[model samples]
Target: MTEPASARRITGAGIVLVFVYGVMALAATGRSFVQIVREFDDAPLAYGLSAAAAVVYILATLALMFSRSRAWYRIAWIAVIFELVGVLVVGTLSIVLPELFQHPTVWSLYGSGYVWIPLVLPFCGIWWLRTHRPAAVPELAAAAR
Candidate 1:
């Protein structure tokens, strides 16, 4: 017999997505930590935004990694969507009000500091999650009925 839908969902491209998210999580965490520890005084808002981005990245990574679960799938969507909004808002603000961002954030300039991965990753994640969503269980359906 073939693997279950949940198992198949996390193979191949799914694995790649998870790996990329994991890397992004680590990178964001490290960058934010350094900024907060060393120079938060110089640009509190920018550094705080970086820290918030790092938290979002970490949440997304964990949620994606465990997305076989329905709850985790929901969390993944929330985290990824939040990340996208954060990127767009911060990127636009950084450009329109440059003085507000004396320092670059992970999301500043549409993730220019990270070569735009932060901007693009969420779209990819949404696509991946949509395509890989777990098939509804008959038990749940029957219970609901």
Candidate 2:
């Protein structure tokens, strides 16, 4: 017998993570949507990247919320890694090539406009996932013992 995967997905800490990711997804999606629709031509690169970040956030949130299988776990890792890469790349570019971004993306300067949460969240997520992985089945549990 085995503990179900879904049960492990919503531990106390997991709930907090889910809530934060949900907020980030909504905030990024809404901000980028408004900026892109209202003034895309003003900062195409910034708005486009912001929109892309929003999508990534949404996917990451979903993956974490429903991480009931190995596939979902892997997807969550991929999304978070992508997010980390995006923030680092964009943060560096914002500093090195300021002219390329007329305005700020969600990842601008390592999420300076968002108080650097974007930079910190992915690391937290990966840590949580690694520490709180689902338990193995009876056979594997015995094998380890």
Best by TM-score: 1
> Can you give the TM-score per candidate against the true fold?
0.92, 0.86
Error of 2 at 18 (Å): 1.2
At residue 30, give the lDDT of candidate 2: 97
Q: How much lDDT does candidate 1 score?
A: 0.91
Candidate 1 ranges beyond 4 A from true positions? 1-6
Q: Give each model's clash number.
A: 0, 0
**Which residue pairs in candidate 2 have backbone atoms (N, alpha carbon, C) closer than 3 angstroms, thus clashing?**
none
For model 2, the stretches where C-alpha displacement exceeds 4 angstroms are 1-6, 135-145
Model 1: how far is 124 from its true place, Å?
0.1
Q: What is the C-alpha RMSD of each candidate to the true structure, in Å?
A: 2.1, 3.5
Query: Which candidate tops lDDT?
Result: 1
lDDT (Cα, 0-100) at 67 in candidate 1: 87
Candidate 2 lDDT over residue span 1-145, tens digit each: 8978765567888888888888889999999999989999999999999999999899999999877666787888899999999999999999999998769899999999998999999998898889776556678779988
